[model samples]
Target: MTENSNMQSDLQKDKKFQRDPHFISWQWPIVVLAAGCLLYYLIHISDHSLPKEVTIHEAIENTNLFSSERSRNTLRKLTKLGPRLAGSIQNEVHAPALIEHEVQEAQSNAHSSQSILLQRQKGSGAYFLGFKLGFTNIYDNIQNVLALLEGSDGNHSILINCHYDTVAASEGASDDGITCAVMLELLRVLSMQTLRLKHNVIFLFNGAEETPLQGAHMFLKHEWAKKARIHVTVGAAGSADVNFSSADACDRFVRRFHGRLVAACRLSVTVSN
Candidate 1:
């Protein structure tokens, strides 16, 4: 009887201890502080925060700069033409004409120091996918719209490539039309008097990528291909691939380009704010 009573007493004491207000009071402050810290971290320290929305006036002012509005407009215009499959009228004739017009406009407005040369290249080639696949693709009269921006050192150049063609039944706005619009904007910006280049830049708007890289293969046979020391391919379906002659050159170019991109993003954010 005595032992059972002692056990009951102990149980009651433990229950009291478990329910102690002081213990909870001490823990509550700490938990609140932790939650507050988490909220602060999420709101201020994280890069995942949404960007501030830009007003119409701010967008209009930034048109001379890399403008999202203008890019979207260009994309809309391209996508409206429908799927530009390789060998289709949209891909071969209409798309090339539109891109050529844009490049020509940029060339006309280019700075005196910069000389923009536009080329509509037609060529034929065969590409073997791989030994394992044993697939050979042949192309005839594949068109490539190339714009060369001559710099001080014209002997060496960098090639920026993106295909304008898309798979059949797809609008391809995101797959390549957006990228084409971006390239157009980049050409316009680089042609400004304020910017000067040491090595030439060639923008290649390939028309037969859906035909499995036929346009690029055709470009390899072109005279301009000899001057290309580096290749930068931007595709939505894949990551950006930069190919350079040397690892050191690749590292230097990546670092420089990344820094400039970050700076541009910050500047855009500031302007929007």
Candidate 2:
């Protein structure tokens, strides 16, 4: 009876093995795919890292002397909001609150100086024309934060815009969180400048940019856009080239700078010549 039981047990074990799929074998393919994905990610990140050839001056143009410690502070504040996707909870509630606070603080600073004329709208609820994002059935909502450093000459206004929204999965520390922080720093610096500006500079922090550039499209509908002689947009993940569509416009802008060429990384500016 003992021997018969032992043989029966062996037979049951063999049947179990036959019924089970090769789970260990299946794991090997998954492991290979994971490894391939990791390798690809590393390669891509290395390629898009900040360019080594970029100079201090070029970096300054992007960072504005790192805004003397305020750069990191503003960046930290924005990153604390985490991924700000349009219609997400962060986008709907937290991001706007934080941005409103920051803008109020910056505006207070802007108001401190009697030398410059400044006007700001803390939260402008502008609706962008809705469109589906990529393969997803998501529609964009426009939420733009605008401030104008109104120059003495209002005949020609320059619009400087940047998107503050991040993609669905990213922390957006680099994507546009940095841009927002830089804009704050720029606002701070420009406010402190004693020299009078030649043209009005509109500071626009746009939303819904991660989805189909809805914020930008809607920006064109603004009355200020019609009066803008120059439009400067600050958003390029890791590019350094300053692309000018028209050489004549570039020349005129350079001349306006009084022969000072400020190297801008990933900055595109359009000016009517």
Candidate 3:
């Protein structure tokens, strides 16, 4: 009888606990939190997926400068002359002829006001000497393509430099072709602008860059390099990753930009051997 009484007491305790209002139910709270999070995520994704609007001027600038279609077309033309290695027949002859043809095409356009000129510099011939082989000399000529946009203030000039020559067996589409195409497009765009610029812009396409930067060394010997105050020089080191690295002038260069359209970071690297 006592055992039966104890069982009845335990049963009553269980029933009381089950009916207590203090015992919190988590089901509704969890559902609400989950729903809130899902709604927030949907809203965030929709906000980011929407298209951005641009001004008319920005649209014009986009079409005129750095047009992907135009650049790609130029790249195609460049790659047609495959493997423009330094001192090779393709680099020495075909590349120069192609550049000249493009220049002539640009000149023939009735809309542009820039002057296109081709300057040829004699390259330092290659030589190899060893015990197994005697000294051998190979002659390779350097050609520099220049497009001049003379500004009202002729004292200052900006040099845009890119090499047309490539390493052995490289089509150089990214190595330097892109840079040359960009320079050409920039010249075309600048020529179309009605407003006169303050400083002259010179486009310099150097040859034989793969062979000890001989083209640049030769350019320094020109009369234009002597008189002109070279404001900026944009060159490529055979890649699409656009990184501007100026030792002391980076801060000054950064000060010229005023928008958040692109992020720029200054990095210092240290190496140990």
Candidate 4:
């Protein structure tokens, strides 16, 4: 090759190199800063945010009946089946079956358990009692459970409560199922313990608190109208939101029980009339 040809090649290479910029001045520094910020955030250092926590334990004690894994399994199964609305055929297919299964299992595990006793309403053209669910209405459903557990004693009692039915299209294992699992676990622990209580404890799994308070109205039907001297309802499941609200008797019970656990976590108080 001639010297001119070689020089032409060299010039072309230099021109290509010049056209391709190395560090577009601001781009490199900005990218570096972004990467650094990301790292800082992940590590939760210097105004950073960290990812969510993995479970250490149930965050409660003794009865680990409601593991997140088990609850998740229930959720997935319910999701596959779809929603569980009231007055639907699914009440027979899924809702009552789901709760009855739990009640039986809880009883087998030796908790001082109670069932709704499976009665029926003769009016309304058909039976209504078995059609009614447990976890629907908050205020009245709770009262009915209290009446069942009244056990003919004239004293106050501790109430453990949870709602079991899911919202429309919701496969909610965490929402209220978590609360049910918690109460079941607590009951299991208490049952296992040798200690006896002065006040009778009522375990309530209410139904249909989602829409109008039908279960509640039926529950308070002059029989359990008198509020339990103490009530202990939980936040909708999967929530550690142990708050007292001005909704019903269970709210008062929740406050009384939480008054003991305040040292473990800050208890928010709000009891309804």
Candidate 5:
């Protein structure tokens, strides 16, 4: 009986040892290491992720709002409004609201001392003309226009023209809106002149250069161009590529601006002559 009782006690002791959780082989070290590694990785990732470039028109294409494509489509879309008869031929013309909005915005960021209103009426028949653009302000008012007008006086009278208002309903990427931008850039660079200008520059931001040189014609009604000896009408040759420099258009512009087109914008020349 004593031996049986002792055997039962030994069995109970064995069962208790087996059921104790702490007595079993544990993996606390590995579990702790895994948690610590996960936490370390999370902290490292949080410290390493943050933005680099900032510009209003940097990703011009990526932004769907005012890209050049939008400008072109806007103009094409507006032709349905009604036909604007340029006397002989009738074509659809866009309104100036969108361009006006853009100009207003540009004025806010510009540094022009004299911002002016450029108005060119419709050109009469057989009108040949020239245009020059400098940097233009985005946001402006009537007073800004008036101030630009005030700065027109020089030794000789000349034309100061820009396509201020864009074509109505246009995503107007090109068709002279881009020209207006070129004009603004010109304005920014040209204002550093300490010497008096030779001609009285008549600043004209024609509402409809795309329509029919309307503003240019309006200004031409006066004897200013003839008096100022306006020999050249400068036009930008869009953009260029280094690889296709031998293309006809590029080659022609290079020769044109340097030789006979003295009144044109001087970009560069190929030959030493």
Candidate 6:
């Protein structure tokens, strides 16, 4: 009886050893990783969430607001013209004409308190790209289509820039055409009689960006650049590339712009919900 009891006790110890092994288990690590991922997703997912879409009919009824459908239509028209390379007829002539037409259409509906001024600037200049490039880029008759919306106080201005030119063998719809379309839509919205502005706004549709920024250089030589307090260059959708002469100026503008954007986004989200 004592021998049998000792054997049974040894077997129970073996079973216990099998149940609780000394080796590390992967299950707990996997569970921890999954929990961490879930926590991260819950924390940061809102940044990736999209806003409610606006339909074409809703956009048309609300003429004073921005319309993605209208912008998309404009993009379609611009892209239908095909590639608009620098110095080409499509870039220098046709694109400018289309932009001018759009500006004129916006101007017709502009508020009585606002004045829209359009300029087709022609300029020639040479500038050193950098020591890395080790060459000077020269350009002549680089076209820039500029539209200025004079606000109640026109002493200071904000410049929004986008290029309409593309490289050879590419349609350049996403590269810049969409940005131009968005600018057109913004101009329309800002010109509404219901809205009031404290400072003037300039929309620059540069034609020589694919030529490596010659249009922007030409704009610096223009008298209008003097009044420009802020410069926002839109390379693509959601790209808010800003350039300023001073760090302090950029900081101030960024702070104000960020605050306004956050407020607007919150309002949109609340209204959608």
Best prediction by TM-score: 6
lDDT string, candidate 3, 79-122, tens digits: 77887877678777887777767666655651444444455555
User: What are the lDDT figures for the candidates, one per model?
Assistant: 0.79, 0.64, 0.64, 0.47, 0.41, 0.81
Which pairs clash inside model 2? none
Q: Give the lDDT of residue 152 in candidate 2.
A: 67
Top lDDT hit: 6
Worst lDDT window (10 residues) for model 6?
264-273
TM-scores for the candidates: 0.68, 0.57, 0.61, 0.51, 0.33, 0.71
Tell how far residue 93 is off in model 6, in angstroms: 1.6
The candidate, 1 or 5, that scores higher on TM-score is 1
Q: After superposition, how far is residue 102 of candidate 4 from its true place, in Å?
A: 1.7
lDDT for 172 in candidate 6 is 78
Whole-structure CA lDDT of model 4: 0.47
RMSD of each: 6.4, 13.2, 10.0, 11.2, 18.8, 6.4
Worst ten in a row by lDDT for model 5? 139-148
Give residue 7's error in model 6 in angstroms.
Answer: 23
TM-score ranking, high to low = 6, 1, 3, 2, 4, 5
lDDT of 4 by residue, 142-168 (tens): 211221332334366555655555578
**Which lDDT value does model 4 have at 265?**
53
| Model 2 regions lying over 4 Å from their true place | 1-66, 111-141, 238-273
Write model 2 residue lDDT over 114-207, tens digit each, in one string. 2333333222333434355524333434566677776767788888888778887776876777777777777766764555477778888777
Candidate 5 lDDT, tens digit per residue, 6-125? 999999998876765555346878888899999999877754542323233542323212333333333444333333322212221233443334344444533355343333234333
lDDT of 6 by residue, 83-196 (tens): 898888888888899999999998897767667899999989999887585789999878899999887888999999999998787777778888899999899888865656
